[model samples]
Target: MADALTRDGIKYMIARLLENANEAVEESKENKDDAYCAGRKVAYYEMLDILKTELDIRDQDLKEFGLDIDLENKIA
Candidate 1:
């Protein structure tokens, strides 16, 4: 997809994904198959949004989480 996302766009998309995940969790409890899949996908996408935003922020502003960043390259 040539339409690669920008930071602002990713922010909006993440907000929407979080919203959808909230809805999906509720819906999944009452159905089978795709409902759970939809819920998990929403959660995954929302986390992606969070990581992207976090990375874009200046290091001075990032709150310390005590995470071992030296060991991994987290995917967005």
Candidate 2:
């Protein structure tokens, strides 16, 4: 098993999980019949919730951790 994660590690995971969840959503849109896509979305979201709770993270904390994603390229 891996060692306990540092705060940065958790934040990094949070960012990656968010990205994966976003991808799952897009994939689900393309293939609504894919059960695996729905499962991935649920798993990623649950993991994110657990990690965020462990770190007591808020939306602002995500931004502070540089995890504020602009998946839609909305940020200029």
Candidate 3:
């Protein structure tokens, strides 16, 4: 089996995935199928959540990136 990815590796991949999704959203703005694009974006976000869980990423991890999200409090 392949070795597991490091936390940094996962972070890098997450960023890349988000960037690709954002670009798709921008391009999709010109398309007529908004619902399909929105659905795809939701799927991408769910994948990000999976990666976050795989790394056991929490509020503190996000704080390191300047994202002051209160995961426990449902605030940001």
Candidate 4:
């Protein structure tokens, strides 16, 4: 089996995913494209759900790394 992720590693992964999602959201708004925007929105929410569910990282764990469990607030 693959090795478990370190706290730092998990934090980094979550941060990167969030950043990508935020960027996609911003691009969709700026471009004002419907089709691709829909896809980007789906990808962003899917990633957010994975972070909340599949990773199962606790709120305190995120706080320890100066992150927040409130991902919707993090979205741009």
Top candidate, metric lDDT: 4
TM-scores of the candidates are 0.39, 0.62, 0.55, 0.64
Give model 2's TM-score versus the native structure: 0.62
Specify the poorest-scoring 10-residue window by lDDT in model 3.
67-76
lDDT by residue for model 2 over 4-74, one digit each (tens)? 97877866766677777778777767887888876776676666656545444454465655444443332
lDDT, candidate 3, 1-76, per-residue tens: 9989776775577668767666655655666478777666666656655655644555346533322332222210
Q: Superpose all Cα atoms of candidate 3 onto the true structure and report the RMSD in Å to 1 decimal.
A: 5.5
Model 1 scores a TM of 0.39
Candidate with more favorable, higher TM-score: 1 or 3: 3
User: In model 4, where is the ten-residue run with the lowest total lDDT?
Assistant: 58-67
Error of 1 at 22 (Å): 1.0
C-alpha RMSD between model 4 and the true structure: 3.3
> Which residue pairs show backbone clashes in model 4?
none
Report model 4's TM-score to 2 decimal places.
0.64
Q: Over the stretch 4-49, how does candidate 1's per-residue lDDT look in tens digits? A: 7775585576556556655555565556477556557556555644
Off by over 4 Å in 2: 1-4, 57-76
lDDT of 4 by residue, 31-74 (tens): 77687875886677677776676444543554554344666655
Worst 10 residues of 2 by lDDT: 67-76
